[model samples]
Target: MKPGFWIAPEGAEEPVNIFPIGEEALDASHKGLTASGALAKLASLDSEALARSCPRAVELLSTIAAAIGAQTAGAPTQLFRLEGLNDLERRLIDDVLGEGEVAGVVALPDGTLAQIQESVLAGIWRVRLEADERHDYVEIGAVPEIVSRAAADLTASDIAIGPVPEGTMNALPVLAEIRERALSWRPGQRSQTINFTLLPMSPADMGFLQQTLGNGPIQLMSRGYGTCRVLATGIRHVWSVQFFNAMDTIILDTLEVGGVPVVALAAAEDFEDSAERLTQIIEAYFT
Candidate 1:
């Protein structure tokens, strides 16, 4: 809703590349389905037969179409439960909701893991909670509840002010600033960022800050005009938001204190395009 959320972040205008430029990275960075890619992937499969068999899956897609039309991103998610679906029904849901740009995982306190990914349609997310049991659902919103909820669950109310270790210099004030902002930040408050890349940080100071605000389980990557990785840290409401160039160099590294980084979430304006594309796919095949 603010000015800087949707605009491309400050960086090179090249497309985002998640993996490094190596043989192993190439193997790991396999591309997901595109519009044409989806067609190729399903060329042999009978669309009408699958759709006819999975009525509930079709209904789920229709529901997503309607909810996305509302354009209420950043609000409470509109969830469509996927439990009790037979194997065929599951295939129908999985095939149509191809992967989008953003991907994330949040480990819950109960030790269960919530895998979150945006669908090919923006503002539509696929959340799977897995561990002892598996639960799948489609959450229509800007970002999944698991992500925002995990941020709220951070223990940042009062960080443990430990003694400064050997070689520690200049990290005290940084931590203090972080702690003060974290304590005062509310859900709707404007986000505050301390750009470490712009500031001066020595080896020892950087090490101390990293260890103090360790990385948390929730990590989100937005593959837009360059990669923007949003990682929640051990400190409450504090996050490490790093922007990378096409060559995978860390162009900007900052610690944001407040809510999850807006770059990782789809903006309200993305809803119409997503709805139209999904509705087209449904009418073409799922109908």
Candidate 2:
């Protein structure tokens, strides 16, 4: 155990023992997503519909698997256009790729917004790439490229330092550190996370921090026993990542300086597992 506390004067109330999560609380916040568990949730699909009419959907699944393989081998994401799908085809695709644990909104290239939802299988994402008029597509990758691009593009490099408002404590220094780290951060570099739960932050400080780094359009939710909401601030390479418990209490809060935080992105192992699991589902039901 790491034993450390703030050096304060006598009777100064250095209450820094912050981890109050009980055993039951910890148990409640587990990552309940299991590959086998996901497989068992599928009831009997309409075999006849998929076999007779949904040939294109079947081809798309196979293509997704192939693309996932490429992605595992470090290839760029593969996009399958969902344009011109008939009712049955679209429904089949939708029913098969039920919503997963991660969902978010990202800005499209044209500055419009698009909803990005992960499929039940990890690393498979449904997002509208184009702006205006439904042009949705499925991307098989660790994460959709648009998510990172939007985060990067929308993050303003210049963060202005204003006079510290009255009653605010340490927010200015924190902002300065964030600005310095964010401006110097580069791709493939290790990011820094400043934990606020351990800091002495006044309400005014928090307000000032939020006001200085205005919210960006990129917002994502990764659901588990609770939810980890990743919000991109207007400042470049700055993200506000907060984890809330079942009762909506923020168990952890931090500002991250770098590219998109890793909590929001699926991993290569996720892509591989998703590809395999979906292939198994297809073979068992659609074939």
Candidate 3:
């Protein structure tokens, strides 16, 4: 209450208003009780499947838990190959690790295809590599490593800026700016992103830049809440990054000249935490 305001009688003030603004307690106990009851109901629903899981499935779960523990302790990610898993075992694994929202499908230069899918349990990933042969793997991390590794090998090459066509006044300046930025770039430097979408450029200016920059082979597509595409430009390190809405409409378009776009890479700390959570999930299932 304000110093000059009338004092309310004992227990007259609303319990919520009694606490000053921004000072309310979280009151997690109420939520915790609700969550515990809900989880018990869910456990009852999955009791049959939990009991029916095969010994192989249990062994695989334990192995995954141990791998997560190692990863949490700053070890590299562990891959549990699923090649030998029978159909029933696969089903059991699916029952325990449901799908999550974040996933990526990338095409490697060798024509091999790889898919990384997160599980409902954060940090646990299902990674599948397909070429002439198929290999299935389960990985525990914040995000899959291949997504970043695939882009790492691409090197920036020199670009020969062509003469700016007539009627494109600012195109030459833009090109010069980009070339200067690219030449000065070094590893581990702060990222510099240029948003051509925001610039006042004519169609001819865009055409000149696109033709001069050219295109590179490496392309990455990652999906979560929406979609993001990173394509290498002929000028090494320079990439065309585009974000799209659920309807596939372009929302943001820009050029990133860096090792890789920050959004495309997962933080190490995130992986560490994911590993810990994954370990807990496995242990809880057993208990």
Best candidate according to lDDT = 1
Residue range 168-244, candidate 2, lDDT tens digits: 87888888888889889998898899998888887778767777887676767788457787878878888888887
lDDT of 1 at 9: 25
- TM-score order, best first, reads 1, 2, 3
For model 3, name the residue pairs that clash.
156-236, 157-236
* Number of colliding residue pairs in each model: 1, 0, 2
lDDT, candidates in the order shown: 0.74, 0.71, 0.60
Error of 2 at 224 (Å): 2.6
Q: Give candidate 2's whole-model lDDT.
A: 0.71
For residues 1-287, write the lDDT of model 1, one tens digit per residue.
Answer: 11111122248463222222222322232266645666556556887887778898888888889888886765688888888788888777767877777876777888766877787777888888765324788888879888888877876566776777787667889889998998898878889999877676666676677767765768677776787778788877888888878876678878898888888888888888889888888888866
Cα lDDT of candidate 3 equals 0.60
After superposing candidate 2, which stretches have Cα over 4 Å from the reference?
Answer: 1-42, 108-111, 129-134
Candidate 2, TM-score vs. the true structure? 0.82
> Which lDDT tens digits does candidate 3 get at residues 1-287?
11101112348542112122211121211122122443344365554466465667767877776666556523455677777767877766665666554544545677666756666555677777655224677877645667556555556556687677886756788777788888888867877888765777776666677778865544444555587666666676787777768775567768888766666555566555655655565566545
Pick the TM-score winner: 1
